[model samples]
Target: MSDLLRRVATPCIGVCSTGIGDDVCRGCKRFCHEVIHWNSYSQEQKRIIDERLDQFLVQVMQDKLHIINAELLAWQLGVQRVRYPAQKDPYIWLFQLLRAGAGQITEPRKYGFVVDSVWRDSSLMELREAIDREFYLLSQAHYERYIGRYMQKEG
Candidate 1:
């Protein structure tokens, strides 16, 4: 397959909220400009964005949980029909695994994850809430770092 054909797909989850003044898409956490210009970006540009997102997610997951059986976790996510991109980012898989196992992941370690005290001491809903909060915070920081500069030029 050609490079374009083999490129990883956009991470859009269909819940686009960027058009409503949100700096980041709640679904995919991409900056508004990134979403708007995604189709116009070159493969290298797209890869850069993907890598940045992966880095953020990896930071969150590593700080909050430890995966012991990564293979089994991936299999579990697959069995549950969680739709994750084909990229090799473990954090993406971890996100899907948490979403799929929500409420039912009482013993995360069995699935190869060791929940950090930040999450271990909280209920499932609380954990999910914390993750969402942290994710959005990271997204906002990213938007400020990248897009804020352009905004200053326009003012």
Candidate 2:
């Protein structure tokens, strides 16, 4: 029995959140009753628990992949408009990227007043152009046009 116990062992990540009263792990969804009786359980029981855990992790990873793919599709559509545009303003699609940047900022003042005003405007295309212009100017590496100390030299 001892040899079997040693051979039928499983791995634990030690983030035990098995609910005290619920009889199930709040963190990993493993049953608390199974956990409490882990030593007494058969090898087959442990295998079933492990399989269930693997399935749960796979679902979590798949959901993340779906979200990432959706964002990429939206970006690709926006890019295609820029590359082969029949309209006067091919670059108008870039406003979505700028609006996205505004949302990602942790601090409000980092991007400057022009960006802030664009975010406030009703026209999404105009807002996108404003952001693109800002990006182009900044990419030139000039500090004069920039609001603050733009890209300081590393020590």
- The Cα local distance difference test for each model comes to 0.77, 0.40
For model 1, give the RMSD to the true fold: 2.3
Q: Best by TM-score, which number?
A: 1
- Among all windows of 10 consecutive residues in model 1, the one with the lowest summed lDDT is 83-92
Candidate 1: C-alpha lDDT: 0.77
lDDT of 2 by residue, 25-141 (tens): 434345555667778877877766655544444343232212223334345545544232122121222232343453443432322222233244434355444433443333222
As for candidate 2, its clashing pairs are 95-128
Q: Tens digit of lDDT per residue, candidate 1, span 62-125?
A: 7887777778777767777877654566667877767666777776766666778766778766
Report RMSD for candidate 2: 23.6
Collision count for each candidate, in order: 2, 1
Name the best candidate (by lDDT): 1
Candidate 2: stretches off by over 4 Å? 1-11, 66-155
